[model samples]
Target chain A: DAGVTQSPTHLIKTRGQHVTLRCSPISGHKSVSWYQQVLGQGPQFIFQYYEKEERGRGNFPDRFSARQFPNYSSELNVNALLLGDSALYLCASSAYGGSGNTIYFGEGSWLTVV
Target chain B: QKEVEQDPGPLSVPEGAIVSLNCTYSNSAFQYFMWYRQYSRKGPELLMYTYSSGNKEDGRFTAQVDKSSKYISLFIRDSQPSDSATYLCAQRLVGNEKLTFGTGTRLTIIP
Candidate 1:
């Protein structure tokens, strides 16, 4: 089966610009989550949407937002990007929205801000 | 202090040797633990997942969790060159979907 997939495998932006990253979950998955991974660091959770509803959010600022569609795909939006926002944005999916379910991740969208 | 701590080792090991990776966390609320392996520029692939404490083994990989000490470990037996990559530890609390992750440990299996 196809794993979680992300779009815009790589992107380059400048300070004060906005960027949007997309993700499509595994066919049978119902929950989608977003994470930010800085170079050499682990992925930090950003947002999770289960059945198109916001389920959880991480420590990211208000500039980072996400939404899941009816088809279980998700999009992460960042406004007024900063150099610190340069990182790999990962998307994960699970068959269920619970903690017990296994989460699968995508290759991620690499974003660079100058 | 960071919630999770892991040594970002550029650890080198010979093929067929035992490889062990570990992480420590400060949060007691985290009840679900998982280990993921990632190749360069790729997404993490789940290698092990466990809840509560104790140990679970899958094929050549073993996962050990010590909730009392807030420590978790992943051990690979008869490691092969294909196992060379970054290993990451992740945790989530019951009823929560957000995961907290430790900085990955890079391993190199010398053939």
Candidate 2:
């Protein structure tokens, strides 16, 4: 089966612009989470959705938002992007929103804000 | 202090050498420890996972978690050049969905 898949593997955007990255979770998975990884750091969690509801959110600002659809797909939206926002946006999926389930990640969408 | 701390080593060693990577976490509530391997321009792939305390091994990779010391480790034996990548240590609490990650150690296995 295909793992979590993300679109627009790479893109460049100007500061203050908006960007939307998409993700399709594995066929049987019901939870989708978003993470941001900067150049030299490990990924930081952004948001998680399960059954089309927001399950958890990280320390990111209000400018960052995400939603999951009925099919268990997800979209991460960032508004008023800044140079600091440039990073690899990762989408991960798990069997459920609870603990003990192994989370699988996608290749990630690389966003460069200039 | 950060929840998790790692050496962030650009550690290099011979292909046949044994490699050890470690992380220390501040929260005792973290019940699950994991190791992830990430190649450049790619997302992290789960390498190993361990719960509470004890050692779990898969092939050449072994993951150890010591809850008493708040320490976790990943050991790669008879390493190959294909093992060269950034190794990340992550921790999760029993009821939390988010993972706290270390800065990651970059390992290079030279042929």
Candidate 3:
């Protein structure tokens, strides 16, 4: 089966601009989560959506938000971006029932802010 | 201190040698442990996953979790060049799906 997929593989933005990254979860998967990985750092959790409900949220600022669609796809939005917002935004998907409910990740959207 | 700690190694080893990577965590509430392998500029691929504590083996890969010490490890036996990649340890607390990840260790198996 195809794995989770993310769009806008790369993007360039400037300070004060907004950006939206998208993700399509794997077939049969119901949960979608977003993470941000700054250079030299591990992925930091952002938001998780299950069955279209916001399940969990991380310590990100109000500038960051996300939503899951009826199709189990998701979008992560960042407002008034800052240069520090430059990072790889990853999307992961998992099913409710599984041995470990492993969260499989997508290729990620590389966002570069100037 | 971070919830999860791992050495960000650019560790190099000869092919066919044994390799071990580890992570230490401070959150005892974390119950799900996992190891992921990621190539340059790519998303991490799940290599191993375990619950609570104990060891799990798959092919030449072994994952061990020690709840008492809040430690976890991944070992590769008879390692191959293809095994060269960044190994990341991740954990999630019981009843929650959010994961905390290590900084990752980059391994290179030289031929």
Candidate 4:
């Protein structure tokens, strides 16, 4: 079966610009989560959607938002981007929305803000 | 203190040697422990998952967890060059979906 897949493998944007990254979860998976990884750092959780509802959110600012579709795909959007926003955005999926389920991650969308 | 603490090692070892990677957590409430291996510019891949305070071995890799000391470890035996990558330790609470991760330790296996 195909693993979690993300789109816009890479992109660059200027400060104050907006960008959207996409993700398609593995077949039969219903939960999707987003994380941001800065250089030399581990990934930080951004948002988690289960059954198309927001289940959890991280400490990120209002500029970051995400939503999941009925098919379990997800989109991560960043508004008024800042240089600090430059990082790899990762999407993870699991069979369900609860704990104890194994989560699989995508290759990630690399975003650069100038 | 950070929720999870890991030694950011650029640890280099010769091939066929035993490699030990470790992490410490401040919270005893973390019920699930996991190790992830990530290559350069790639997402992390789950390596081992452990729930209790014991050792779980898979092929050449062993994951050990100690709740009393709040320490977790991953051991790689007969390491290979293909094992060169960053090792990350993560933990999650019983009902929480968010995984708190430590600063990863970079490992390089020499040929």
Candidate 5:
């Protein structure tokens, strides 16, 4: 069974440009979450969706947004990209969202902003 | 202060050695503790997850939680070169919306 799958393993964009990263959750999973991991730092949570509904959001600015599809696929969009936006964008999926959250992560998309 | 604090070590140890990694958190309400291991370019894989204060052993890995001191640890017995990776500690209180992570520690086991 394929765990979580992400597309466009890497990306590059100029300042003020926009980028969209995609993810498909594991079969039968209903929760999807996104995280950003900067160089030399642990990942920071961005957004989480459960059953195609926004369950939680992180401290990221309005430039960052995400939504989950009916099939549990997800897309993370970042606009007005800055050089600091360069990092690994990770997509994670879980059976559900709760106090007992144990997620499975995909090999992240590497984004480099110029 | 960060809710969870971990030594960001590029710790190098020899094969067959026992390795110990630790993290400390300031939140006394955190009930779930976890350790994740990440390879160079891949995502993190959950190594251990324990609730409350106690120890859980799985094969060559052992996870310990000491809620009294707000500390947690992961031990790799008979470490191997394949064990080289970054280890991250995560904690979440019952009401927190997300997991709070500590800066990861890079571990390399040499032959």
Candidate 6:
């Protein structure tokens, strides 16, 4: 089965600019979550969407926002990018059942803000 | 303190050696624990997952959890150069569907 897919694989943005990363969950999976991983660090939660509703959010700022489409695809948008925003953004998806514990992740989109 | 704590090691070991990784957590409510392996520039791939307090073994990997001390471990036997990557420990309350992760340890199994 095709796993979670994310795009574009790499991106570059200037300070004060904006960027958008996208993800498509696995077939039959309805829940999608976003995470940010800095170099040499683990993935930190960003936002989660299930059934087109925001289910959870992380400690990120208002500059970050996300939405889930009807096809279970997701988009992560970050505004006013800072140098600290350089990182790999991950997308994960799982079924919305007790089996939500088994989440599958995508390769992630690497964003560099200068 | 963070819910999960792991040493950010660039640990080097020889091929065929046994390797041990550990994480300590502060949340007693965390009932499920997991170990993930990540190659350079890639997302984490789940390696082992266990719930509550017990042990689970698969192939060259063994995962142990002790909820009393809030400690968990992942043991890799007969390590290979293919195992050279970063390992992250994560924990979450069962049914909560959110995971808290550690800083990750980089392991290099020299050939």
Look at candidate 6 and tell me the lDDT of residue A19.
96
Q: What does candidate 6's lDDT look like per residue over B41-93, in tens digits? A: 98889999898899999999999999999999999999999999999999877
Q: Candidate 5, residues A1-114: lDDT per residue as tens digits?
A: 998999899978999999999999999888888999998899999998988888889899999999888899999999999999999999988887465767789999999999
Pairs with backbone N, CA or C atoms under 3 Å apart (clashes), candidate 5? none
True contacts kept of each: 0.90, 0.71, 0.67, 0.74, 0.60, 0.62
Per-prediction TM-score to the true structure, in the order listed? 0.96, 0.98, 0.97, 0.98, 0.96, 0.98
Off by over 4 Å in 5: A97-101, B95-97
Off by over 4 Å in 1: A97-99
Chain A: TM-score in each candidate?
Answer: 0.96, 0.97, 0.97, 0.96, 0.95, 0.97
Residue pairs of candidate 4 with colliding backbone atoms: none
Interface RMSD of 5: 1.9
Q: How many residue pairs clash (N, CA or C atoms closer than 3 angstroms) in each of the candidate models, in the order given?
A: 0, 0, 0, 0, 0, 0
Q: Looking at candidate 1, what is the lDDT of residue B74?
A: 98
Comparison by DockQ, 4 against 6, better one = 4
RMSD of each: 1.1, 0.9, 1.1, 0.9, 1.4, 0.9
Candidate 1 residue pairs that clash? none
- Candidate 4 runs further than 4 Å off: A97-99
Worst 10 residues of 1 chain A by lDDT: A94-103
Q: Candidate 1, residues A1-114: lDDT per residue as tens digits? A: 788999999999999999999999999899899999999999999999998999898989999999988888999999999999999999999888455888889999999999
Q: In candidate 5, what are the lDDT values of residues B5-101, reduced to their tens digit?
A: 9999999999999999999999898898999999998898989989899999999999999999888999999999999999999886674446778
Candidates' DockQ values?
A: 0.82, 0.76, 0.69, 0.76, 0.65, 0.69
Pick by DockQ: 1 or 2, better one: 1
lDDT of 4 by residue, B1-111 (tens): 999999998999999999999999999899999999999999999999888689999999999999999999999999999999999999988867788899999999999
Interface RMSD of 3: 1.6
Error of 3 at A106 (Å): 0.6
lDDT of 6 by residue, A5-99 (tens): 99999999999999999999999999999999999888999999999999899999999999999999999999999999999999999897884
Q: What's the distance in Å from true for residue A95, model 4?
A: 1.2
Task: Tell how far residue A2 is off in model 3, in angstroms.
Answer: 1.5
